[model samples]
Target chain A: MKYLNKSWIRKSSLFILSMILVSPLFAWAANAVDYSEPLENAAHQIGAIGEGYSLFSGIFPEYSLPGTNIVLDTAVAGFFGVLVTFGLAWSIGRIIKKGNE
Target chain B: MHIPDGYLDLWLCGIFYLLTLIVLSYSGYKARENLDEKKVPLIGVVAAAIFAAQMLNWPIPGGTSAHFVGGALAAILLGPYVGVLSMASVVTVQALMFGDGGILALGANIWNMALIDVFVGYLIFRLFKNKNKSIAAFLAGWIAITAASLFVGIQTGLSTIFKFQLQTTLLIMVIGHGVLGIIEGAITASAYRYLIDVRPDFFEKSNKKEVEA
Candidate 1:
């Protein structure tokens, strides 16, 4: 038990220390006020729902639609993204499972 | 913590994309080697859950809303390889289909949340799970989320394209995320307990060939 405790302590410390070393690379923000906000806006404009897939949720958004709102558009995009992922995963899963069986 | 497009310098984005691609490729290789057919669809479902969970933000104190990233939970439940793959899939879809993150910033987001958080959380849990499961889960979630914030703060702070003081943003990001990380830890730990109660086979490494444990 003593030896096991020592081993865990050593491993935990090492992991913690590595995190500290990499801490400088990221700081998460719940709500951010930074230089990036304006850029996000610009990107959204560039990635308008009608435009090509430029990284804003694939074309579910309709910022310029006659009655569309950005929030709704975003949610629509989220829904689509979820569906696509699940669909792909489920299909591939079946294929793999069948091969194994 | 998705940075919209045009936030980071295009060159910086390029670099991050390259790095993310390399890391993701390695993760794919690992998954292919270790994963079994039975668990493949679960990865997809987990990714879908994470992507959906991120959209549901509840108000935290100080006018901020916090949402589940699910990186830690995925790692704890699925192991590192599957966790990373699921997260990567979630991140990719969020970018491609929902535009949750900037196209250019997708790599950075993946680097922070998918790669760093999942790896850190999984490694910690694997290390300490035998002794104290709750502590392992809690610590894994906390560190993973906190580290993700730190990673983003550091990048945004250091970037010349953004005219913000690195110290201020870094401090705010760290402190803000520090508070949120607690919630993340609690959620992860509780979720682990619940899942174990319901799906003990998922954790029984000896019983399942597909599981990462």
Candidate 2:
């Protein structure tokens, strides 16, 4: 039993460590890059939406809040994005599982 | 690539939406039939991880940037059907909350990123797994994006809003993604290898075929 517990803890720690390593990429990207510019340039004037819409528009570079930085906005967005996505997927999976039962 | 609203005509949008609806419905049915309860949280975790990973965009030489699209990774971890649902959740969240992709083009974006990427990647991985598992994963990630890009090229090429010809869009989307897909392939391979090492039983339990490999 103790061996199993140690294995589980080790696995969980490794997973958490991987996530930590991956999380820094988001911060680096938020600080260094403008996510929208490349898409806008690729889409051209004809198709580019150019930040006129979206619930979190203010968090982006085009319509950022007065006191907020793009890095902060991106971090906030990333945090919420993970939460919402997990919730949605969990709900969908639960529904399917219940239906199957 | 997230397709913006004006990029595709309403007619194209409608068609893709219809297609997405059909595929998602079938995927749902399959998930209900095959998915285990233990796998549910795995789905959520995978979706969340993919969503967070997408924020890391590597700027390409042309005007655009590329990021890791984990459809292949999802499909490899969860089978194709559940993988579709996982990716669909991520895409939907990105559109509604972040305005990452256009509202009108949500269907097309789901079609490309969620549907084509997951299905094609799964197929490639299965086909090539017998030879080498890591190389199979690499090809899955690389070709899946390229195939998804082909559809984007078609949709944008056909749309009246975009001035680019079919050939131009095809060349741009396909070649550009083909190059960037190397990074995606490496990431997929590395991630798969790590997961296999840490939780070998997880993959075995997820799919019987994974046990064979």
Candidate 3:
């Protein structure tokens, strides 16, 4: 918990927070519809899955989480994405570093 | 922009996949040669930050939303090759976990966003850094994205399934991204300014290593 007070962590958190604040969860800005849906549908005729066949597809609606509250879902999803991204990059970096060493 | 499935034909997707593979292989080789243990955490943090920031979508006038694609910022902070890897991870995750993009079109998406965006941004930043770093950062963000958009326009326009003429798609993508790129540039410059102020040691070390190498 003490690590939370670190300057970098604090700064990073603020930046991430600012991003989430601007997201559709807050409705501060007009949410743009994905214009690709028509193209995706056209591709579907040729066996394309469009949005994707992933389990989480459409559940998050632009990568936000699913929950009773859309706002909380978006915030939680953003934070979760950050953690996952950090972990994935860190793991890859470590592997690359160790491979070189 | 995350391209969904069916946007590109399989043949084009395959070609882009091979291209992406070649670039990523070279980037991995470069990373192995140049990466430092001390910088590993920074890569993770930068990737994470980029991923988070990408979720913030800014509305464009015509009801289309544009989000910050942070490849330029990543390249500035972590060098070009490492920046590609960071962005690759972010794009890969977005496709795989979130299904934000089509699995079949993933290769093309990566080629456009991760490879083109990062390298162009890095080259632009390096080209003009001595003139004015902040402006250089801004231009890097602006031009790199526009360049990437050119490719997206080409890809979608060339595909038979897309239904838009090549000229029309090209104009729309380039012009739209060119305008949205200003916002991107401002954000990149601001973030670069903030990071440099807070983490001068990181840039100093990165620059010193670049000079020595």
Candidate 4:
């Protein structure tokens, strides 16, 4: 029992220490992936829209029905996103139930 | 929200991963305490179900797709500790089998989605427990998922900001997750409601313990 307990403690401590050492490297890699330049330009252009200035105007801003803004698009997107998630959850539930039976 | 490879600061991801591991370990202990040996199969089946469900992608409004992260639902059914463990299992399997999320990102993903959504969501549900089960479930599931998604979004935005443009990345993340949040909320609500009808036994067990207490 003593040996087992000591081994467990050593394993746990090692796991903790390794996590501490490895986490920073992951964060640095994440920081490197930020797409700032293009996003900044996009935000700037979007901010300029109310000033009667146009960028990417010829692309037909209304992809769907007329007068639908980004908010509406987001709402629409969210609605479907929820549906998909629910379907997945339910299907998983069904499978689990089946497997158990 | 499924965090990609480069979404969070490495340090933040590491911290989250450690935190998740701690929570998961604790939760696993608690689950072992509460459940009998016979329950293991049921839990395994449930975990598998959640794992498979999480992989199914549905299209969102902006031509993007999102999947289920079943933290809230698990908590609602199995209690918070068990819920978190179940979520951890699902996430671990996904990372290993499907490569849905990054290995390093697993910690953050589980913390943001599983720990937050399950525990926080269950707390909220308990708050509204006196009113109605279905309503409480809906509210809990909806709020929990939205909150988790937002947390993920903010983390993503911050990571992006650390490297690139702060404001733009924040804006994109917020907008993307805001939409994602609504979807998460709706799906959580629907699923919770469905389970309430089908598996009242699971929900009832918690209620019985409370009443017995």
lDDT, candidate 3, B29-59, per-residue tens = 8888768888888888889888877776655
- Residue by residue across B1-213, what tens digits does model 2's lDDT show? 887667788899899999999999998988887788777777888898888778766655443567899999999998888899999999988887766777788899999999999999999998999899999999999999989888898998897777668887788788878988898999999999998996776677666733332
Better of 1 and 4 by TM-score: 1
- The sequence of per-residue lDDT tens digits that candidate 3 reaches over residues A52-91 is 4433354356655655555666677777777888899989
Best-matching candidate per TM-score: 3
User: In candidate 4, which residue ranges exceed 4 Å CA deviation?
Assistant: A1-101, B160-175, B207-213
Q: Compute the interface RMSD for each candidate structure.
A: 10.6, 4.4, 4.5, 17.4
Per-residue lDDT, model 1, residue A85, is 67
Summed backbone clashes in each candidate are 19, 0, 0, 5
DockQ of each: 0.15, 0.37, 0.37, 0.03
lDDT of 1 by residue, B1-213 (tens): 776665566777888899989987776665655566556656666676666666555544443466678788888766776678778777777666656677788889899889989988877777788799998899889888888888877776776666566775567667867887898988889878976785676666522433433
* Backbone clashes, candidate 4: 5
Off by over 4 Å in 3: A1-5, A21-28, A31-61, A64-67, B208-213
- Candidate lDDT values, in order: 0.65, 0.78, 0.78, 0.55
Off by over 4 Å in 2: A1-39, A45-66, B60-63, B209-213
Summarize candidate 4's per-residue lDDT along B1-213 as a digit string, tens digits: 555454456787778878887887776555544543333444544454555454334543333455566676777767776667667666655454334455667888788777888888888778886897666766776678767756665565556323534555556645655566565656666777876675566567654443333
Docking class of predicted structure 2: acceptable
Q: Comparing candidate 1 with candidate 2, which one achieves the higher TM-score?
A: 2
Top DockQ hit: 3
Candidate 4: residue pairs that collide = A26-B10, A27-B9, A27-B10, A77-B61, A82-B183
Q: Rank the candidates by DockQ, best first.
A: 3, 2, 1, 4
Error of 3 at B21 (Å): 1.4
Q: lDDT value for candidate 1?
A: 0.65
